[model samples]
Target: GTDMGTARALRRNLEAGADSFPQDVVELMGYFQPAGDGQRIRAVPGEGEQVPIWILGSSLYGAQLAAMLGLPYAFASHFAPAELDHALEIYRSRFQPSKQLDKPYVMLGLNVFAAPSDAEARLLFTSLQQAFVNLRTGRPGRLPPPVEGYERDLDPMAKTMLGRALSCAVVGAPETVGQGIEAFVQRTGADELMVTAQIFDHAARVRSFEILADVHKSLSEAA
Candidate 1:
């Protein structure tokens, strides 16, 4: 959540040589100052790397900054989708061209819990539901094991919060997941998707991703 000027200064430092350090970097003046011999201090490994910078946000602030800076924007829709649509709208509408990019680019976060069966996939998703509720209620701890009927036990407030926060999630078997993913992409028109899963079992987690990958491949082929 760095301010625009500070983020710009950091980017300049990373892309500039010691002699080319920005003189207007007030926030990090001392650390980026010239040496006794006259050469300005530079980010050793960072300098001249030309690393790609993507602005990530769960609110409108990040979208505006990324638009102004012409950087790719990523929305944290997996956990905070309340502002996803509005933020993307702001980013695309207010975007400016810059050396790094010529047009606005967007990547949306999504939670995918896939399994061989719809019932199994829904069961796997219970861990994330429990975890989200626990963290919001200030009882945060290690990821809990999946409970058979976790959603049925959540208080109304917690249920509503989860429903809104995780609105971008897909949970099902391969065919069901494929349909869900296609619908999401078509509705959002996102340039890219960043998928995440929170299954408790290690093997189940791995399998979830594998199923998602297969679904992605099928989608690509059909496209």
Candidate 2:
């Protein structure tokens, strides 16, 4: 749910019917403390060992808090990217060096669909396109099987919007995959990159990640 509609609202709604749902909401709140003392409690190290904590967000709020807390930051750019760069800038500039980390570390989330051929990769990518379109159209469900010419079906405006929203994504053959990852790294200088693929075909999905891993390894070696 959106930030405005937090666990409190869900808990309130569930109170009329089920008592257990409200308690579950309370437990969820303890685990998902975004602000206040509860958030600090989540950061506390247990026993003699140090605990590493990371703040996850697609907007500047998490970046600001992560900077203040001196924790690693992970941006959910794969879905929400409107504030990605701005959040990165805020995080790096306002970061306070902590005992656990000496400098700001940023991890960017990206989507990639890699295959032996560009056409094949694009066919695989249609699954994600369908899902995003479904979500935007208010009919989201388990990713339906890929539909050929799905982009053609969408009006020009949705196509443009999706292209912008998924700008961080990379979908292509081996050469294209290598170039895309290389360019992304050069552009963002991200400490780490997390790639996600939403493909309905299990075999194709595994191959997609395998291609990504091989491309990453080859790039690292050549570097």
Candidate 3:
């Protein structure tokens, strides 16, 4: 997510101040090739061991980099959906097959808040909407408890922005969530969907995922 310089600085700070840099930290980092300007690192993990490199992006810049590097691309559509299609198109068209992949593989990030009833799911989703609003308003904190009338309290601009940013979110009952998943997949042709369900209640979060699993299983069986 950051450049090599930032990663190096972070590692150094971790080791110097907190002693938190693990020995395998180098392998866990990702940076761009400096293009013959500086010392080039042959491999991150070193010793010729195969390491999977996935490019995570929220816009086209990341897509182009991943395509150039011939790595799988993951788009953060869960919060940045406006440029998703354009980024995917660029990545697929310019993809250079590497040893790891023969074709462009796209992973889409999404939010899923599934419940037995639409009303409950909508209530649960308020947590994420509120979080997003707080983030946009520069007051981000831990996922807060769901508040009644939270979405309604948001102004028109906030509502529109959240609607666009979280366009990939699927929040509803099992059937509605299933339909949303199918529609998103059809729209993006994503090879994988990485889901985040950010409900504050632990039991409800688990149940949400369980309901999603059941919905996906039923969809698969029907297909």
Candidate 4:
């Protein structure tokens, strides 16, 4: 559904006979550069009954627009870290209140993989890191088994960026990860946190989620 024309047509058809249907338009989250043809995107926000617009990005462009339009901003920090600081700074400085929010609201996406211990979490993270490396080298492939030497193999710059981005991620034992998440939320003041985990193994991914959920529960209890 990349076609705006098709979206408009669908909206018109859906509204034709519906009197009580929800008319609020939901624009799917997508990376949008502010300098790129933004007028078309601006047209999408007020299409039907002042639809809420969320500018999604891993960098500053999205934050700038979200602030300019007084809209919500969602950062794809889970996968990308470049320009993260610029994005947050721009969003906070330029934010203007709207009916939807009394002040600026920012949501950050994180990659979380919680397990029994740090060693286990590292084992799970091996394949995820490898996948990223493969993508960087243009050898995109399915997640592979966790190997022993990924930490040593990554370039210094890449390793540094990954560490910074994952600063908010939940890893290690449940108790340890719960503490990390609590500190992350406190530091970032993110209203919402979206998580994406990749462990190469589907069942292991599920287990990772389960462990994180339990950590959340533990944190709630502690709170």
Candidate 5:
């Protein structure tokens, strides 16, 4: 959630959330007492539910906080990957063991746009490219429909930014997607991968995941 405030205010809010998160969890698990009122509170259906909390981030702040709390960290590399390596290093090196987790666990975000043919997959990827460019150029709105040759129309700066931000994405046929997934995993050593796609057509979006699932099955069988 974007906080509408100054940097200091944002920091204060983050600190407050961090301090209260554990207490919230405890309250959800059963009992909590307000510091002021002499009353106990507990969530109705939430109490006694075993829920796991994972920290999601695209920067060092999230990594540091997750490490300090010994929670699993998920990097939003699908869109923002510039600080991924450094953030992972910091998290793993500084992790403190807690009751919930003992060792550092990392999940990486990846964009996969799979189709029957490479050209079709690339066409599907234009939607994401257009959306990203629109977002970076201060024209953020609902995701626009894909345009043919979207990158060709982009300015040099926009092109460069897109290349850098979407470097973690894989867009191609099954074979190409599989190879890209393998390369990304080998390079990052991520414990898990979170895949996302932003194809314009609903059927195409569904087909993309279907293709990815087949690719995953094939990879598993081969391994």
Candidate 6:
């Protein structure tokens, strides 16, 4: 997420040079609002190629801009679920359809972890969940080893939110996880799901995608 000048320059280069990239998709990070004079988003004058910019925000500001501009919006709900509902409501209610779309298109971030079994998935998730806890406690560290027990130690509220957040996540066994994710996609009506999975084992991380692909195939067959 660069400044407006950078964005404009990049677009210019892409337009002038090789046409390998798509200039229409300008994914903007809404968190980096300009600080002072000449720093505001006015840098992006909402013109030139009419770049389809999507305000990526974890709060309301992004939603407001998306609505005003009649553009799409993406929420970082995976890591920051606290403001999800409010952000979604603001974006939808204020949305004004543009020529590009008749309705607001919203996307949510999600953390996904897939494994052979529920027990194994939980074991693999320990490292990733611990990383989140570390971020919260300001003691960030590399993915740690899978601990023997964390589900039993976490508080009920924390556990509940984590479970809900991972409802379409950290699911185990291809069949079960596949069913869970299908249900999630159906219920959320999400056009796209951005997944961020954290696994301690590098090889295991690669395998997660393979498992996910298989699950997707299984679900499609069922449908």
How many Å off is the CA of 214 in candidate 5?
0.4
lDDT of each: 0.84, 0.81, 0.83, 0.73, 0.85, 0.69
Give the alpha carbon lDDT tens digit for every residue of 1-223 in model 3. Answer: 3367667855665567324322223324333322233433334434245557788889888888778768899999998989999999999999989877889999999999999998899999999998998999999999989887888888899999889988889999999999999999998999899999999999999999999999989988999
Rank all candidate structures by their lDDT, best first, as comma-separated numbers. Answer: 5, 1, 3, 2, 4, 6
Q: Cα miss at 180, model 2 (Å)?
A: 0.3
Candidate 5 residues lying further than 4 Å off, grouped into runs, are 1-41
Score residue 156 of candidate 2 by CA lDDT: 91
lDDT of 4 by residue, 1-223 (tens): 4577757855775676534221322222221222245333334433334445677788776787778767788998777766766788899999988665667888888788878788888888878777776777789988889888787887998787677655556667777777777877887788888888888778888988999888878777877
lDDT string, candidate 5, 120-198, tens digits = 9998999999888888778988777878888888889988999999999999999999999999999998999999999
Candidates' TM-scores? Answer: 0.83, 0.79, 0.80, 0.73, 0.83, 0.70
- In model 2, residue pairs whose N, Cα or C atoms come closer than 3 Å (at least 3 residues apart or on different chains), thus clashing, are none
lDDT digits (tens) for residues 1-223 of candidate 6: 4476768865675676424222323323221334345443433544233445676787777787777667778888776666777777788889988765679898877666788887787788788667766666689988787787987898887676666554435457776677767766776666777876788888988887789888778777878
The residue-by-residue lDDT of candidate 2 on 88-186, one tens digit each, is: 999999999977578999999999999999988888888888888789889989988877778888899889878878888999999999999889878
Clashes per candidate, residues 3 or more apart or on different chains: 0, 0, 0, 0, 0, 0
Q: Which is the better candidate, 1 or 2, if ranked by lDDT?
A: 1
Question: What TM value does model 6 have?
Answer: 0.70
Give candidate 6 misplaced runs (Cα > 4 Å). Answer: 1-50, 155-168, 221-223
Pull out the clashing pairs in model 6: none
Per-residue lDDT tens digits of candidate 1, residues 34-82?
3234334455555455556778899998898788778899999999999
Q: How many steric overlaps does candidate 4 have? A: 0
